[model samples]
Target: MKGNRRSEMSVTEMFSYIQGFLSADQDVREDIRKVVQNLEQTAREILTLLQSVHQPSGFKEIPSKCAKARELFSTVRTQMAELKTKFPVEQYYRFHEHWRFVLQRLAFLAAFVVYLENETLVTREEVAQILGIEVVREKGFHLDVEDFLAGVLIMASELSRLAVNSVTAGDYSRPLRISNFINELDSGFRLLNLKNDPLRKRYDGLKYDVKKIEEVVYDVSIRGLAKEPESGGDK
Candidate 1:
């Protein structure tokens, strides 16, 4: 009877432990929250830009990609400015600092790597979308952003595995997954620069959503990578 009671308590304790760990997955929550916030900013800035371009804003249900892009550009510039001002995180394990960054970059990479390694060809529309590519129109297909996210999510898993190590290395306010994404993102931005187009110079001036995201990504990464503040200097 005593053994049975002890076993029951052990089971209960195990359940509690599992729940506690799951609930306290701070990195998971933080990464997700950051993603959500960035998406929010994207939507807002995109809206403002689109409105400016469209005049009526919602005259048509499906707007042109150019209009959408213009909208995307408008708010991203301003939002990024605000993000740069709010230096929330101290360490930049994920960046020079923390901000609205990808929780999905590493994961996206991981999933893509696996699909390639396994010779698994993606057939779904959603899978291709998250990869930031065009997809085929299939019969009876409800293709949408969800499909892309699904594909990207597969990569995100691998990213999480590689990135978690960095977080373990650093204390709170440092996440390596975020750092890796930012680093890659920073490289991507510089690589995409065009110098010859009519709007090349203007593009440089107009804030890309990429740059806004960078601010947050760099912010987090900076906090993680920054040298700890010197102690006993003047205070």
Candidate 2:
């Protein structure tokens, strides 16, 4: 009889605990909202800086711009770490949806810089590492794959502009290189089974970017300018 009574008391306590969990803490939500606001503002600033990446003379300015973006990202990571302590994985996603755009922009800015310098793709793992977040999705809050992919898509748009700008700046070979990079990126994207959402929409936008680059290349080629070697000169 004593054992039975103890079990009944445990059950009662478990129900109360569950009730508390069901309500959640409003204060935490508000705190996360405040953090999101700060992050959004910083993200906007970073986006502005990243715009320079596509300009004719903007490539040289990217390293410094990226530095500023990284500093803001550090602040974001601190807020995320705090939120992680108070919430579970799903809760993280709830708050993450609010500011994930900022993360994408920041990642895109950094990754684009790397691409400009090295003519290589910046892997998701590398972006997450630079952003000071975990790429793994074992249990708790982690970097979202969709967010990273969106950032990559954003880079595609920037590259499209860079392609046009390169020609305007008289660097035809850079657009050809960019065209190849974007083509490979597009092929890689095709392998992914995307849902009918923003990802797919962004993926569709890639075709336009490709067309713009191709037009640039074709115009150059048709004018008997295809065989010229790339001149190593700063724009």
Candidate 3:
């Protein structure tokens, strides 16, 4: 009966659990390269989707986002591969959606990667600069970086929540939190459509919220704050 119940569980969750159990077993291991390839392939799928669409022009038109998403997934895949090599891909209980594991896992990784990039790679001023320039700005760009980061933070916050919820609540008996994850992505996608008000003649699409954006960089902010002032303390 437990086996039957397990059969109904999520593939991803199962894989996660199984990976945990056989941590010492070397026979069922996954290759890091294979995981990376899977991650890269999915990213290409997203890029192809965008290329087919007529995206709006603007500084916010981060054309490389797809590539970045792929890279992030690749990182997670690499982690999974290592873990799987040490463990197994099936958990005793169900916690993953077998069919959608790739995408869901990718979403978490993509959001995580975005969170990191928001900290180290992109800056609010740089984002603002992108919006300020006429060539990029005129096409329809402006943003409230705050709004987007809210979604990312929400997404990251849920990772812990979902993981716990799965173990304690056994919610993985069903679909788990995929909807919320997708909602986070939707938040990002919606930002794609927002054009700064026509009367304002500013493209909100390219605008970024400094405070909200700062949330995603929580770790980086801590590091930045921890450092001594470049000039040193008061004399």
Candidate 4:
């Protein structure tokens, strides 16, 4: 009888432990959701601001837009910093899913700002710096490589659309520059041994972006809107 009583006590204790664990998990997730919501809001603002690049006179406003986006990223960093504190450092992966999508959006926004300001691809390290996260996984709450690549792919697509708008805005030279940039970016992507399905899918979409920009460049070149490349080879 005593043995059966002990067994019942053990079973009850196990369930009690599990219930407590589940409760704690729920609380942490709720906190994380709140932080992630803030991050998403800031990301949306940045995206909206950057979308002006496709406007008729958007090129003229890039500098100001980039500056505003930078200010929004500062808010993202603060929210990310708060997110990092919601869960234990060692459990980064455990809670990362809650913020993964937002992180990718933030990465894309940072990349977009960098490109608008400097016409250069923002490095993964630079994205992390902009989002105020660590570059090293061991340091906790770091940006994942896949997320960065996804952002770059998204930026490439945006650039493709920008190439079309640049022509409408009477900036034929910009398409040629965009074509070269996308080509180089495509080549760099081909060199990676990507195993992530989502990232690989994004990489595949890059070819379409490449083709679209190429068509823009071709149309611009054939119409004599842009200077022709030298006869020998690409300059």
Candidate 5:
């Protein structure tokens, strides 16, 4: 009877240990969610700044606007770094989808800043470094391609609007350059046999962006305003 009672007690203890393990897993996820939410809020603020920066601002003012957005990006990057360190073991990829929206937006903002400054597209590798994340393949996690591509799509739309706004603000050369940039991006996207549904939808929206920029270019060219479309390469 004594041995049987001991065996039953051991079974109960093992069950409790399993329950505790599951409970800890839940706690970890909850903690990650809370942090991600905070990061998401910050990312949204940065996006707002990026979206608004090109609106009738002086060229001298643009650098300040970009600087402010970069400051917020730095904070978001720090939070991401912390999350990477504390992300529950074996659950990094699983939890990554939770933060996908914010991550993609952050990626867009990083590239957008570069685009605004240099009129060039930021490469995926440069964005990964800016975000302080690795692009590991074997038994390691990397920044999702779909996320970065989504950001670029979003950038395309913004640049379309920027093209129009730049013309209004007396930067005539920018609209043609922007039109060319969108066309090039559209061509690259068309080459990909995309399987991601959300990415495909965003790629579909690229046509609208392309058309809008084309209209802007046509309007400028009809008025004899824009210079020749000589800036071809992505610097």
Candidate 6:
């Protein structure tokens, strides 16, 4: 009889513990959702600002747009820091799905700003720094490599569209530069042994971006719209 009583007590205690755990999980998820919503809002604002690059006169204002976007990242940094504290570091992956999409968007925004400023791919370290997160997982919340690559793929697509718009904007030289950038980016992506399905799918879309940019460049070159490479150098 005592053994059965003990068994009943153990079962009750186990369920009590599970109930508490589930409650805490729900609370944490709710908090994370609120924070992610804020992050998404910031991302939309930055995306809107950057979309101006598609306009005929937008190319000339890129520096200003990038500067404005840089300031907004400070807000993102604060929100991310708050988000990091909502759950234990060990539970990162447990709740990662809640914020993964927002983080990817933030990564893309940072990459877009860097590309506009220097026409170079933003490093993982740079993206993490811009987002005010860690590069190493042990240090706490960090940017996943897959997220960074996804962002780069997104940037490649955006650049391909820019190649088309640059022509309409009377900037023929920009399409050639974008073509070279996307071609090299495609080559780099080919070397990664990707396993993540979403990332792999994104990488697959890169070829279409490459094709579009190439078409823009070809149209420019065949029509004598491209600038001639300088003596002793082909760009």
User: Each candidate's TM vs. the true structure?
Assistant: 0.28, 0.79, 0.21, 0.94, 0.84, 0.95
lDDT of 5 by residue, 115-208 (tens): 8777788898877877777555343445788888998998998888888877777777788888888888999998999886989998999999
Highest TM-score, which number?
6
lDDT of candidate model 1 versus the reference: 0.39
Going through the candidates in the order shown, the clash numbers are 40, 0, 31, 0, 0, 0
lDDT for each residue of candidate 1 in 158-213, tens digit (9 for 90 to 100): 33332343233332222332344534533533565465743344334323433443
Q: Which candidate, 2 or 4, would have the higher TM-score against the true structure?
A: 4
Tell me the tens digit of each residue's lDDT in model 2 across 1-235. Answer: 9999999999999999987865676666776677667766766776776677667676556567667767766776676676566556666666676667777876786677567657789987878766666788775566688888898899998888988877776667777788889999999998999999988999999999999998988987887665776453232
Candidates 3 and 6: which is better by lDDT?
6
Whole-model lDDT, candidate 2? 0.75
Which run of 10 residues does model 5 get worst, by summed lDDT?
226-235
Write one digit per residue (lDDT tens) for candidate 6, span 128-171: 99999988899889998888888888899999998898788778
How would the candidate models be sorted by TM-score, starting from the highest?
A: 6, 4, 5, 2, 1, 3
- lDDT for each candidate structure: 0.39, 0.75, 0.36, 0.88, 0.79, 0.89
Candidate 3, position 56, lDDT: 28
Which stretches of model 2 miss by more than 4 angstroms? 1-25, 62-72, 82-86, 224-235
Model 3, position 89: C-alpha lDDT score: 30
lDDT of 4 by residue, 82-122 (tens): 99889988888888789888888888889989988888899
Better model by lDDT: candidate 1 vs candidate 2: 2
Off by over 4 Å in 6: 228-235
Q: Give one digit per residue, the lDDT tens place, for model 3 in 1-235.
A: 9987777777778888888877633333334335445555665454343332122221123335535445544444454444334323333112222212343333433443443234222333343332131113232222234332332433444333333332232222111223333344445545555345331222222123222223323432355532333221111
- How well does model 6 score by local distance difference test? 0.89
Cα RMSDs, all models = 24.7, 4.5, 21.4, 3.9, 3.9, 3.2
Choose 2 or 5, whichever is better by TM-score: 5
Supply candidate 3's per-residue lDDT for 41.
64
